[model samples]
Target: MIYAGLDVGSRTIKLVIFDTVVKESLITETGANPLRRCREILAGRKLRRLVVTGYGRHLVASTQGGKVVSEIRAFAVGARYLLPDCQGVIDIGGQDCKVVRLSMEGDVLKFEMNDRCAAGTGKFLEVMAHTLEADIGAIGDLALTASRKITINSLCTVFAESEVVSLIGRGEETAAIALALHEAIATRVATMARRVGIKGKAVFAGGASLNRCLVRLLGEKLGIELTVPDSPQLVGALGAALLAKHEDGQ
Candidate 1:
């Protein structure tokens, strides 16, 4: 059967097409407007099942024929599919960060989210990248090369931008500042994880998890190793696809 999953996140839309009989999946990403993008992607295909998840899941569901699942549940299902033993999941998206503790059966036990601010999110890193005139893809490598460490105290994106400018004027190296930015984001995520009681065998998913520097910083702050799926950004979509199959069998 051809199963499809769509995750309508704030900054991007992720789509996954899975062939259950063949046990294969094709993943794709598009800018916002998930409903339109999803229709565009599945236009010519015959979808036996469809499921939606993420920030704009409701809109996607309204436009498309599918059940909308919570982002936390979708992420946990995706993480568990990737790492069957994972007990916790940390997903940092463009505008929010979530820490979800999952049960052995892949159900959410507890969850915490930071959605009130852009701090500790992918948007924060994007702003920092713009401040340093650095490419978002290159920031991680640059941060890894930093010889000195700098501390960024402001968790608010606006104040942090001002702080970044001041540090630049003070002759602080860009690499150090980049590392500091990752550290700051990691600290906020770590604080959120603590509230939900992060456990070992933790899995990290989402587009932000693609940054190795941020992953390393998070590992240090959480004081434990974190497992990342092969395609971190597709986890939510993957979970949605899996759920679609499960519902069909019900």
Candidate 2:
């Protein structure tokens, strides 16, 4: 029987099905009607066990029926499974960022999360890309071409946008501005990782993990190698699926 895990997040929904190995996995934008998106994804599938996680986990659990797991637990478990020797996990999602420190046994030791604002998150990157009038999907790659980027001090979304505009008016290179924005995020995330006392290699998960610029900058700033799964956004869902399989087996 296939066990399923669903991570219904603010910006995207991830689904994972496991039968000895991961047999099915998908990631889609949450869109305006996230519940509908979730329902559509789960349709016509027979799942023996289901576990829900992410920002909208409870919403999915109450309406769709599944075991609920916290984002912290899901990331820890998922990172541990993907990188068995991993000591921590960092997830930079659409609206928030999470840092998890793990024990050798894959238990959560300490974790930090920034969900109070859009600053230093995927939302920030999206907005910055829009402000630069650059393709959101290509912004990361474009940033990689820049020789250097200017300093951005504000973490607030509105303030940062204003800063970008001022930089543009001053004839700052578009690529440089984009690179600076990603640098800001890297600085913030690296600071969080250090504050959490993370050691050894860590798994980088969530949609933002797709941004190569952010990944490289973060890894450099932290002075540690970051391991990314083939499908980083599905890590939470994979964790939930593993949990579902464990529960069903029991």
Candidate 3:
């Protein structure tokens, strides 16, 4: 029997199929219609069990017929699978940032999120990068070489963009602006980690985990080296698929 996990995120949909061994993994843009995109992604797949997760989990479960798991649960499981000694998990996705502390047994102890806001998420960085006329990923490289961190007063996306414009007008270096923006998010996420009591190396997952600037900034802020999976963005889906594989009577 085959097991599958589907993560329907705000910006992308990730799928993982497995049973003892991973058979396939894929990611595609969420686009305008997630349901439609999901259907397109699963056109000819067969599975004995399916697990759905992420913000759009309920929407997909109702229409697509699958069990649902919270992002927190799935992430913990995935992190542990990749790094058995994982003490924490941080996911910086398109719409929100999440931090979770875990037990050695892979159970979720505590978690925190940004209240359904785009304050320090991938979407927030995308917007800031556009306003700065810089490549989102490339700016991280620039930020690394910058010496000073420009203070980003507001975490709000709109106001931050305005702030970026004013900085540009003032002729502030783009790298400084990038560092400031990255600092804002890294600082906020680190605070959440502290609240959850995550003091050791944590698993950094989700799309934003790909941002080198965020990785370095977050690691420095937390004062701990972070661990990232080979396929960080698929961690949630991978966990869900593994869970489905373990479900009885599959």
- The number of the candidate with the highest TM-score is 2
lDDT of each: 0.86, 0.91, 0.88
Candidate 3 local lDDT, 1-250, one digit each (tens): 7899999998899999997788899999999899999888877888788899998999888877889999888888888889888889999998888999988777888999874778878889899889988887787887887778779999888898899999999999888998999898888888888998886768999988888989988898888769988899999999889888777454
Question: Per-residue CA lDDT of candidate 1, range 6-33, in tens?
Answer: 8888887887777653244545555655
Please provide, for model 2 over 86-163, each residue's C-alpha lDDT reduced to its tens digit, 9 standing for 90 to 100: 999999999999999999889899999999989879999999999999988899999999987578889789999999
TM-score of every model?
0.94, 0.97, 0.96
Off by over 4 Å in 3: none
Question: Which has the greatest lDDT?
Answer: 2
Q: What local lDDT score does residue 191 receive in model 1, on the 0 to 100 scale?
A: 91
Model 1: worst 10 consecutive residues (lDDT sum): 21-30
Give per-candidate clash totals. Answer: 0, 0, 0
List the lowest-lDDT window of 10 residues for candidate 2: 147-156
Q: Is candidate 2 or 3 superior in TM-score?
A: 2
RMSD of each: 1.7, 1.2, 1.3
Question: Which residue pairs show backbone clashes in model 2?
Answer: none
Residue 96 lDDT (model 3): 86
